[model samples]
Every structure is written in C-alpha cells, then in structure tokens.
Target: MSDPSRHPPTQAALGILFLILATAFFAVLDTSVKYVGAFVPVLMAVWFRYMFHAVVVTAVMLPLRGRSLLRTAHPRFQVLRGSLLLAVSAISFVALQYMPVGEFTAIVMITPLVVTLLAALFLRERVSALRWVLVTGGFAGALLVVQPGGNVIGWASLLPLVMVFTYAWFQILTSKMARTEDPMTMHFYTGWVGALLSSLVLPVVWKTIPDAGTFAILCLIGLMGTVGHFLLILAFKRTQASTLTPYLYGQIGFAMFCGWLVFGHVPGQLELIGIAMIVLCGATASWLTARDRRLPVEPPEA
Candidate 1:
C-alpha cells in the first residue's frame, strides 16, 4: 500500500518538465567538464566551473533578489551543504581524469539505491522488498558497466562511486532543508558555498590558468550547471519528486550522445548492454518508488 504520509503530491506541471530538462543540461555540463579535462587537471576544471557559476549566481541574484539574497539565517547548514557539493565536484573532476564522461555518468545512476539504503539504515525508514530488488539490480548493472575484472575498469571507476555516495548524502540534506526554506534561498546558499570552498581549494593545487578557449568552455560549463540546478528547482516546484525522478535516467542517453560527439568515444557492446540494464533497473526503481508512494497503507492488526 502507498504511504500517503511519506509522499507529497506533484507540485506543478512546468516544474516537472524543467527537472527533465535540468537532467539534460547536467549531462551537457558534464561533457564540457570532460572536454576541458583533456587539457587540464580535473580539479582545475572544477575550480573554473564553480568560479564561473558563482559569478552567474551572484549576477543573477543581485538585481532580482538584492541584498536580501545573502540573508541565509542558517549559515551552518549552508556551509555543510556547500561542503558536500565541494566533495562531489572535487571527486568527480578527479575521476574524470581516469575515465570517459559517459562511463562516469553511468556509474552515478546507482545513486537511487544508495539513497534507499541510507534512508533505511540511517533514517530507520522501511524499504520494500521490491525496492531492494531494484537497488540490487541497479548495482549489478553498475558492476557490469564497470566490469572490475575487465579492461574497461580502472581505479578511477571509484570516483563516480564516491560521487554517488556523497551526492546521495547531499540530496538528504536538501530534502531536510526543503521543509524550512524557500527554493531561491536554498539555491543561493548552495552556489555561494560551493563557489567559496572551491575558490579556497583551487589556489593550493594551483596550476597555470586555462587558455582563453578553455576558460570560455569552463564558463559555458558553469552556465549549463547553473541552468541545470535551477531546472531541478523548477521541476520540483511543478511536480512531485517522485514524478521527476524517472527522467534522471535520461542522463545516460545524453551521456552516450555527448561522449560520441565530444570525444569520438563509443561504448562497446557490453557497455551498451550495461546501459540497457541500468535503464531497466532505473525505470523499475522509479516505478516502484512512485508506486509505493501512491499505494494506500493498511492498518496493522486491525
């Protein structure tokens, strides 16, 4: 039976579509990350991305939101949120150095299972048998995609895994914050904090600045990322999280396309099969989650 208490109804129509598009933009942003990573350290790429994102966030927020935008009553939470983002970005860029963008993105699709497991273990929430099955299948698909024993697997495969665990944690934090703050305020803190943390870190590992073309690409990376996040907000605002979650798997397809177009990289038949497994696992998980959320609860021992 669906747990009405556990799930909320879809927010709005536009928000759902925006979230879908947001995932697409995120895939594109990742492609840019890989393209630029070809010439520089992934950390350098991460640094430039956050720096440019900060500028865009600040510029856009200034006139519309004014100084009011800076007023986050919860500084500690804001910092924590940013710190999570920093870790994810840092790990991801580092991982990109060792793997293609598509492979990295493919691995990240396992996050749904991570979130489910974490919620059950840490939050003491009940997980359905069906959901657990989906998580297991998703991970099995991940291993197939990774094929640790195969030539395709490398130490870098671990980066996206790190990204997965951290991102899952980040989403948990966001879920908590969503109850207490406005979306814009949440976005403000998220961008500003990431920008600040990356700024401080970039100088320490500091290599030479990127050339103009590379720098420009980095800026485009920033823009796409910002749009991607904002699209998430839009999607959530219009539809329930459950409604938007399914579209996330679309990133794999986008990742595949981006991989081919940006780097002339093509997945082998096995990876293609892995992608199919991931798609099935992802779809089943989403449907199960949404289905579970929609089912009516039965009173125990009534």
Candidate 2:
C-alpha cells in the first residue's frame, strides 16, 4: 500500500543491492552479445537484441501499463535519447568482438568522467575542481587499462571507449530531460524508439539469420538487458545516486567472471592496474557527485 515515490529508508538502502544484481545479469547479456557477434555481424547481433527487446517490452507493457507505455510528451528528446542508446549498444557490441570483457568493462567505468564533463559544458552545471581532478585521473587510468601498442590481449580493448564517450553525452541528455519527464514516459520510449530505429536498417545490415538455439540466446539477451535497465532506473528513483553509485564496481567482477568462464579471457598485470585506476576514479567521482547532490538539502522538518 506504500507509495513507491516516497520509498522507505530500508528500500533506499536496498538500491545498491538491486543494482548489483542487475549489473551481474546485465554482464551476462553483454557476454552473450559478444558470443553471437562471433557468428554474425555485430550489427545483426544488435538487431536481434533489440527485436527481442521490443517483443518483450511490447508484451509486458500491454498487461502492466497498457496504453500509458505508448505515450510520451516530447518525441524529439525521446528520439535523441533512443538514438544515443542504440549507438552505444552498437559500438559496445562491435568492440567486444576482440576485447576481453574485463578490459572492455574497465574502460567503461570512466563514462562517469565523460558524463561529468558533459554536464558542465552542455548543461552548464558546476563541477568542483576536485571532481575535475578525479576525471583527469580517470583518463590516465583508462590509458593504463588499455595499454595500447603493448602485446595486450587485443588492441580492440579501447573500442568501448567509443561507447563510454557516447554514453557520457547520453547521460547528460538524460539528466537534463529528467526534470521535465516522468519515468514511465522515458522508459517506454527507450524500448520503442531503439527497437523501431534498429528494425529499419536491420535488413540491410543483417547477414546471417539465427538458428533456433542462437535465437533463444538472443531472446535472453533482450530480456536481461531490458530488465537490467528497468531495475537500474527503479533503483535510482528509489535512492540517492550516491547511495547506489559505489556498487556499480560490482559489475567489474561479474564481467570478468563471464569472460573467464565463457571465453577464457583473463587480464594481465597492466590491465588489472588499469582496472584498479578505473575503479578508483569511478568511486571518487561517484562520491563527489553524490556529496554535491546532498549539499543543498535542508534537514527534515519535525
């Protein structure tokens, strides 16, 4: 009977736990995308992922929110947001083709840095000097993680950097739109826009049709990925960003384990150090962002 809008204190505390669970399963989706990419064009793999996502979202929305899930006030903003997500997903799937999941994921941790900078430049938000310092440190950390030109596992490790930067811009847009939009409107558009956009060019890009087993794998990817984002959005709505930010590091472990178990991809010394720096920067930036958000709040009234 409790309104989810005013989440209980304990519910806020559980946000990170839910985020960690979502991240773990989400990592599996990423690994599966890479697995399918091996047998099909990355674009084709992305196409199927979104189609499955569309089917799942469409079916669920009918029973849950019905026509509300089909409504949104701002179509243009939704289009841009959906486009950004599709780009990030496509870039990431392509990047994973030759990159180890651990290395790809570590580079992705720096996306917060990119988001911080974008927030300052485009959204005109104030970012303290200390946060800038952390962002710079994060850049250096990413270089360490990639260790370019070395006899690394594969030079493709840096490809996810493309996704990170795109995602940074995407997050900034989301932040700006968050004030004007309801979460339901935002969520529905995400699935619908991305699915429709991909479906357009999918016929041109799709090379191989999936087998029955591979089709099932694609379905899993779609369901898990959509569920992961839904859980993430729910978690953030329930708690302070600072409260859940630190737990995203748990994603690294899950990503690495998936790589190890499924692909035998293990990190070498330099990559591990890079992962550490990425972790440090991620934690620091998250702490700073959270602290800033909480600073303007007045004490609760009696």
Candidate 3:
C-alpha cells in the first residue's frame, strides 16, 4: 500500500472520487437486491450474489497473484470473517425486503458506533468521553429514522440493527487480519467462503428463473458488489482511510436517491434529520478514531 503522506494532493482527490463511485455501486447493489428479493427466495438471491462474486474474483485475481492469492496466515479467522459478512448480507437482503432502502441504510450506518462499543468492551480499548457522546448521538439518530409508529416499525426494523452488529464485528475482524494478511487474499477467501457455505443449502432454495430480466438483474447485483469492493481497494491504496472517511457518508445520499427513483419512497422529515445526524456523528467518530490511533482505519464494507 502506498503511504498517504507521500501521495500528492491529486492522488487523494482521485481516491475520494473512487470512494464516492464505490459507494454509488454499493447503493445500486442494495437496490438490486431489494428488487430481486420480490421474485426469488432470499437465500437463493444471496447465493447468486456470493457465487457470482466468487467466480468473477477468482477469474480476474488468480492469474495475477497465482497460488499466493489463496495463501493466508490465519485460515480460521478468514473463515470466521467471511461467515460474519455472509450473515451481514443475509440480514441486509431480508431487511430490505421489509424496509425501504433509504431508511434501512441509515440504520445500518450506525455500524461505527457499534464498533466503538464493541472495541471498548471486548478489545479493552479506552474510550474518551467525547467518543462515547458521538456513539450515543449516532444511535439517537438511528432511533429517529426508525421511530415508533413509522412504517418501518415492528419486527422488521430490528433487522438492520442486527445487520449493524454483524457488520461491526466483520469490520473489527478485518482490521485485525489486515495487519499480516494480503487484502486480496482475504477478499478471495471471503467470496469463496460465502459462496461455498451458501451453496450447501442451495438445494432447498433453488428455484427456476421467472424471466431473462430477473437473471440479468441477478448478474447486475454480483457485478455491483464485486466492482464496488475492487474500487474501494484501489481507493485506499491511493489515499489514507481517514482522508476518505467523511466521503463514506455519500452512500446514504445515494441510497435515498435510489429508493426515491425506484420506489417513489422519500424519507419523512424526522427520518431525514436522523439520517443527517448519523452521517455527521459517524463521520466525526471515524475522524477521531483515526486521529487517536494515527493509523488507517478499516472502513465498513456495507
């Protein structure tokens, strides 16, 4: 990885651009998953996502990295990391089925706050008072988005909260493994682990495609996910994660746009305010985290 301190300002600018594009792609992936969920079993859709991602990544990366692409210093941790992500994806797919993309996204955006709580509790990390305030404020924002009596209320609303927890753990494990593992290798295992594990239950969830259009959309989901992560890797290579952290909130805006464009769904006033609060608090918390450690923070993949 190139040191962010050594990079020219133009490189950081390019990294920001890449990160924004990557977020857009993720928004598209979420929208596509929501659309396809209506026509297919959620499990089947999840399988296609990982299957396509695993195959495409293997095809492109194997030749470039050779057997080294499959090498890993911590095989068990890699599997555990991949399983956590699969849980995240499964929760996301099911949650999107019951909730609007924009609101669901805002709730999942509380991941950094959850990560902070987990680190302080389980990792024995010290938490400053200000960081605790940011974490509380971030969750408060999430409550505004999923407030009682809203359309998203009921058991469905808890789905994204569950996703936030699962994804936070995923981010934590990735940060630990990144210290010694090749990122590309970890990426490879993640895809295959998700694909292979999901495949075990595919026999029951398998269903005939209703049409070519549905099939195409499935392919689009895979393409968006694979390309989005690839761009993220490229972006981090060009600039420091702290330099790019603020821009990560761009996904919330993109998700709102996608929800409105596809479903004519717009967030209510409180929901919008809630979303803004999440963006503000989450970004500030990330900045503080990077500042305290003086190391590149591993970003949330969702």
Best by TM-score: 3
Flag the better candidate by TM-score, 2 or 3. Answer: 3
Each prediction's TM-score versus the true structure: 0.86, 0.88, 0.97
**What digit string (tens of lDDT, one per residue) describes model 2 on residues 163-270?**
887887777677667767766667677777778888888878877555888777777778778778677766776677666767878888899999999999889887
lDDT of 3 by residue, 108-226 (tens): 87888888999999999888898899999999999899886667658888888988988988888888888999989988999999999999999999999899999999899888988
Worst 10 residues of 2 by lDDT: 293-302
Candidate 1 positional error at 286, Å = 3.4
Q: Clashing residue pairs in candidate 2, if any?
A: none
| 75: Cα error in model 2, Å | 0.8
**lDDT leaderboard ranking:** 3, 2, 1
lDDT of 3 at 44: 86
List clash counts for every candidate, in order: 10, 0, 0
The lDDT values for all models are 0.70, 0.74, 0.86
lDDT of 1 by residue, 205-232 (tens): 6767558898788777788877787776
